[model samples]
Target: MIRKLTKDDQELLMALLRKEPALNLFIIGDVENFGFEQDFMDLWGEIDPADGRIKAVLLRFYRSYLPYADGPFDVEGFAEIIRKDNDIHMISGASEVVKAFDGEINFKQVKQLFFAELKEMNNKISESFSSAEPIKKATVQDVEAICALTDTIEEFESSRNGSRTSLRKTLESNTGRTYYIEREDKVIVTASTSAENSMSAMIVGVATHQAFREQSLASRVMAQLCADLLHEGKSLCLFYDNPHAGVIYKRLGFQDIGSWTIVNM
Candidate 1:
């Protein structure tokens, strides 16, 4: 049976989420900080009637759906939920699970991404970055400039706790790491990590301006970011749909763990 999650279920949720924290990073972080009452969350779970325990977890929020199922789940039931909601912008999950649901519905586009992770550099990577300027961790003062790079600020602000204000709050947190390259007070290249903890982190938001594309700026920032994370004993992970991006990451020592599929409906 699928039902809504309540605050009282936190301990149970954490146990399952911690089992694969990297894939469930965003879900874990959000629920840890806030409970089920957050505006962006439409959290649900599939409970096993036989065992009286949750077998699968689903989060529907921020125009996307993320599902994690280690045991049996109601795939058709969950797909029906997506079928009813007109707001689903993307569906992301373990490749097999996402593909199973994708086959049940028609989406405008589907992206099969490589979910890669790195615990150590395969070889010597330059500790030095030859950029136009030094790349460093972003502070709260640089939040606006960073937000300017993404064209989806309005949607982000509408998505509860994903606003520019939320970005500021994340930067305020010690675990939230956003790095970038700035030129004349404007950010041209950037990389960021979300759902950070002592054990692992999810690396996202790696971008570079069109004009700065060939300068290896993204690599510089990413290498620095991954190096920093691995140095602190955190396994860094990312999802990439672009082969070119994958090539860059492979050179930097990331190995393909599996695929993360995203379907847009």
Candidate 2:
């Protein structure tokens, strides 16, 4: 039976996460904040009448994103839940689920699958190049600056659609981090990371001012961000649909784990 996940399900979900470490952290964190609602279901395979073992589970996010993993569950029952909920954009992992819904509804294999990649950092302090400018962690005072930087990046990359509201949500979360480079007191470059799980994080919203395109500030900020995350003992993960960005990340020691496609329903 598909039903809303309650506080009682937190332990179940966490256990499931341990079984599937690659699950997106945002979704995991979201479930922790707002448990499943009536429109969605946490697909538990089969409930044992006796011990209540949640064989498998998936969090249906606002009927918008459905990710199912860590299961020895009933695929048909899960698909039934999706059909009832509707408007679910995409599901990650398990090709069988994809196949089940392939022709029944509009579906696309457009998610970039990622695995943990490590780059050892040397505590060696390199010369900090002063640009008559400064790099700083974005504060609430820089709301406009932050939004402008994010819009610039999204405009440059058509596939990268980020909302100021969403960015603000992360900024206010306190757990995430956003860094900026300012020149002549004007924000010129920006980068942000979302701490997904205890040990993993994703970098997004990397952008540079138009006039500063060839200046390599983006790379510098990226390098600094990577160093910071590594220092905190978090494994860095990045996603890019653009081949050029992928190439740049490769040069910076990020390896491509797999490809993912996102379908806009």
Candidate 3:
């Protein structure tokens, strides 16, 4: 049976999600930040009648729907919830789970990206980046410079999906953080995290200035960011569509765990 979850279900919900914290980073973060009181967010769960335990979880945040299950789940049931919502904008989750909805949901456009997770730093890369330029944690004052740097990178132009206002809000809320390296008063490279909760964080907006692309500046910045998060006992995860970028992340001890799928409705 499936039912809309309430605050009373928090313990059960977290127990299931924390099983794979990296896979449920966004869901967990949203629950932690918004809880069950937000008008724009709601959660549903599929429970096994036999065990009275949750078998799958689904979250609707604003216009997006995110579903997760460690094994098999009622894809049709979850899809129906999304289908009934006239404001549905996107459906995203593990590629395997999302694929199960192919026949149930009429997808407008689908995008897939390699997903990787890091639990520990690569000792070799850690040692090398140790001598690199000191990285600084970004404040609200750095939002304009950070966005400006990403705007100049051709690779980031089409994929830059965030806004300056949102970036500043995130920094102010303490839900996310950004680390950057600056040269001559200009931001050259940056790495940032989003959907940060107690168990894990999602890496986003890792970019370097066009003139500094091949100089390992991005790697150094990422190393520092990842190290700091891991030190705090949070696992790190990221999605990348570029093979070259995947290679760099792998060198930092990230392993391909699975793929993430985003479907526009």
- Give the best candidate by TM-score: 3
Q: What's the lDDT for all of these models?
A: 0.79, 0.62, 0.91
TM-score of 3: 0.96
1-265: candidate 3 lDDT, tens digit per residue: 8999989999999989999999999989988988998999999999989988888999999999999998988888998888899989999999999999999999999999999999989978867754656789999999999999888878766656666877898899888899999999899999999889999999998988878888888888889899999999999999999999999999999999999999998
lDDT of 3 at 251: 97
Candidate 2 per-residue lDDT, tens place, 1-265, comes to 4444577776766666555443345555565545555444453434435676555565665556454544445666666666675556666543443444555555654454433344553223223434545668886678677676656654545533545566666778765788888876778888888755565677877888788987768877877887887787767776676777776676667775544444455
Over 4 Å off in model 2, which ranges?
1-4, 19-22, 35-55, 70-73, 87-100, 108-133, 154-162, 195-197
Q: Global lDDT for candidate 2? A: 0.62
> In candidate 1, what are the lDDT values of residues 1-265, reduced to their tens digit?
9888998777777777777767777777777666798787878888888876777888977788888888667999888887888777888888877877756778788778789888787556545555458887888988878878754423234443454676687778755789998888788988888778656888877778766778878888888888888898878789887788899888888888889888877
| Cα deviation of 169, candidate 2, in Å | 2.3
> What TM-score does each of the candidates earn?
0.76, 0.75, 0.96
Q: Top lDDT: which candidate number?
A: 3
Model 3, runs deviating above 4 Å = 130-132, 158-162
| Clashing residue pairs, backbone N/CA/C < 3 A, model 1 | none
Runs in model 1 with CA error above 4 Å?
A: 49-53, 84-87, 127-134, 144-175, 182-188, 195-199, 208-217, 231-233
